[model samples]
Target: MAVLRVSPAPVPAGRRQDRLSTARPPAKLQISAGAHAADPLLSLPDLPTPLKEKILCMEMMGIDSGRALSLNPALRSTPLDSLHVIISFLLTKGIHHKDLARIFGMCPAALTAEPRRDLAPVFNFLAAELAVPSAAFRRVINKCPRLLVCSVPDQLIPALVFLKRLGFKDMEGLAYHDPVLLASSVEKTLLPKLEFLEREVGEGKEMVVRCPALFTFSVENNLRPKLGYLVEEMGRDVAEVREFPQYFAFSLEKRIKPRHRAMEERGLRLSLPTMLKTTDHEFGLLLQTADSSPTVGP
Candidate 1:
């Protein structure tokens, strides 16, 4: 009976059409969490089998995997031929394979660096200007690889010139003991330390040459405190400290103070080495014997 009025309710204006049109196909959800992540090692081009083996060998020789991997990019950019040349040149210079591996492990950049542009000048300066004997070259470079990268005019030459001014004519000794001095800052490190020794202790280049190890010690921590203790506290002469500069190398808290205090209490005046170099057991024995000994009346 109501068929005449059973027509579907009039469609709302644009409702059905809007619903139909607005309904979009499910979007392809793209998660890029790990999909696009880069591999650190993959960024480097594949290395030759031999090269890969060599790197593995280096890792076995105490170079960490991360460091060895980090070197890959530089190695990739550097031609295999260039690496061979560098290795060959170093070998010709008397650097053994084991030493070469150690050096390269320590300074991977040297493996990729330009031989003539980056390394040759340093070698030349050491051999010719500094008179570092060819026989000792490998040993010195092994000790301080930074010498290969340091600037001749800026860093190395100035240090050499200053050392020469300080009567350091024995380049072989300097290269062996303090090649790091060639890589240190002339204005900042070398100058201030030299000035401190000179001004405070009447020590100069001669003292430094005698004990190149002095350059390796810190002025604020090792040199100043030890010198002050010996001079002001102990009333030791400046010349005495200069004569036994190795005293500065001993630990102030552990070795110097304890030994000095023991010696002072016992009225003993032993050489610096003897005073500080003894083992704990030996030192304790000395202290015990000193305590038990008769006190001589002055």
Candidate 2:
């Protein structure tokens, strides 16, 4: 080939830069120097950087970001010493990391609570006064972390006293099954619910202890209607209801009424739980089988 020199394409006047400027690239996220300085987390020199970042990341990614942000001021106000104390004390109480994360995530305010004033008293009360076992204490606190922040004398003590007076002898059962009961209003919630249950099934505390779940059911909607059907309409005794207090949990329209009607029409006798717990198709099949069976004259 002929040694012909080929010229390169000309660069546009504005585009050519032989030497690049030694300047920092513009930041994708612009934050003021004052903001970095004023951050409360940064002000605490003792706080581990990883922990600080974890808290901030958790707040940003929380289910309710606005609520998390609103809570940040409270969190920032908490002394690092207090936060550490709370965490350490909880760990000592046998709470696992996953449970602690879940509890703190749900009630972030608990992290800001004073370990001595807010948390220690509750733990002491649960362990010493209520005699809640370590494992049971962890379970209760995990289920109702709000209990950590509740007033020991005013709220927790009163509720426990009320339940005790109500003959709740199984403290372990209360702790594991319905620790939220400890946080409930004695006058407003617990008393009212107990009164309703007593009115329906007589003043036997054993019934309540047998079915602690009775406290969780709705009095007006579920309990009353179902009790009315079973006791008033079906003529089942309070003793029967007391034996199977879970009957109050069934849906009056969907389960109780339909099943009771089918059983009554077929003259079939079945336990309350069996009748209500079975599916509609199962109930229908039960009715068909009962009808097909020959009746023996007694």
Candidate 3:
């Protein structure tokens, strides 16, 4: 209901003792945001009172009411009080009022989700299992808003357990830096990547631990082409990769190919670090030095 609040009138000095005892705290008023209430979104003919309140509250919180409604149609049926409860629950979790716009804008369905059943468990897992301090909850949640929607037992825990079993040592690092990996599905996203490493790069299974960025790469797009060029084209042994797992971090088309071509043009066979670690000008200096006694590839 739309409320109109008024503060108590000033009491005369002589009657201060009598009136002050009866005076209560001033009533707080909450008005919806945006233009005048008579605007069409709010003033639509015969709009239900609860939904009107929901839209008003959403606008007041800086959320795009239209997008949030489309993303979570349940907003129409959910009570205004329930929406407030969800906001209050998130605030208790260290998500500030300023953070609400981005969070709700990204996962608008969150506004309608059950606070204790659906949401609280994720927070509990972060605090109890991942060891995320309550003060740092905002940092983790903001890093991956999907954490707000993912289930504790079903999605997050299984992935965390899998990463741990695979020798992931930094629990706090994963929670704080890569919570998306935890939010990901084990069967769909994480497992297939590990399986690929076990089958294809069997000798260097531990390389992923040495270089976690390998998880972000695609087998077909990045790993396959680079490995193919290294072995089939350049005739280099795969052990070079085991020695420097950061080999995968370089660009195949830009840095790797150009530098390899420079070495080949000079008919010089340099070590992987010799080829990859130097700056462009330094590599030019190396090539100049190599040109004097260039060795032919056999």
Candidate 4:
């Protein structure tokens, strides 16, 4: 049987190889030598590999990447290592990782803060100047994370000094509990509130130092309206308010006005503490049991 020598498959092997080589394979993605592979779905902004790493890193830390990035443009160029430094530095200062999420969320500047110049001196001032114990560092910082980004000489030291001058005896308590005072401006915030109270009550300095929370209140929205209700509406003297300065601490609309109205309706006049301090149920009980003859006593 004659073996039909089948013709060499379509073309010569060399020609087939030539055709395969000449015909271009589908176009490829040209990634740089050290660049990361692009995300498959979205063509993201052209960001440096390290910067993208920083964003991912911060997002993992529970910071709002969009807000933080927008508020702090420095983050664009901030080295990934710089973020790590800030994170590590805060952790060293007794700040928990969870706490860092809240802290940096509030003040993104802290995410890029210099470890020594910006941060170290804060603890130094807390320890040496303010005499805040090392252990209380976390409590103080967690109380006010803005402390980390503040200038030691410009903000913290001056605020502490001002408070001390005003006879704030419980420095530790102020640092931990009412830290927003330290962040407050002596001229813009603390002093103005004090002056307003002095004008109204004639004992502003003593009252505020006695109850530092007065500084946190809005003079326009809080102090003025509450004092107005106390003097003009309640027919009480400023001296009476001086005795219970925390009267400003309670919500005028929610607690003070309603309770005071409830008292007037029942003809039961209670002291500020007696009226304001009691719960709704207690205040109701007070209205029921107290002499309906309006027993007004400081």
lDDT to native, each model: 0.72, 0.70, 0.80, 0.79
Tens-digit per-residue lDDT, 159-260, candidate 2: 989889888888777777788888888888778888887776785467667777777776787777777788787777777778787777677787788777
Alpha-carbon deviation at 139 in model 3, angstroms: 1.3
Regions more than 4 Å wrong, model 2:
1-57, 60-64, 67-85, 231-239, 277-285, 294-298
The TM-score of predicted model 4 comes to 0.82
Clash number for each model: 0, 0, 0, 0
Point out the worst 10-residue segment of candidate 2 by lDDT. 1-10
For model 1, how does the per-residue alpha-carbon lDDT over 198-281 read when each residue is reduced to its tens digit?
998887677888887788788888898888888787777878777777778888888888888877888766666667777989
lDDT of 3 by residue, 1-298 (tens): 3432334555678987876698753444544334344444455568766676678778878899999999888889998889889999999999999999998998897888899999999899999988999999999988888788888888988888888887889888888877888877778776766677666666434776677677777778887889889988899888888777678789999989999998888888778877888898998988887788665442
Winner on lDDT (2 vs 3): 3
Per-residue lDDT of 97 in model 2: 59
| Better candidate by lDDT, 1 or 4 | 4
For TM-score, candidate 1 versus 2, the one ahead is: 1
The digit string of per-residue lDDT tens for model 4 on 1-298 reads 0111112334556677776778733333332333343332123467766666676667657788889999999888988888888888878888888897899888898888899889999899888876788878988888888888878788877888888888888877887788888888888998899889888899887898878889999999999999999988899988988999999999988899998898887677778988899888887777767555356433
Candidate 2, 123: how far from true, in Å?
A: 1.1
> Which candidate has the highest TM-score of all?
4
lDDT of 4: 0.79
Q: How many backbone overlaps does candidate 2 show?
A: 0
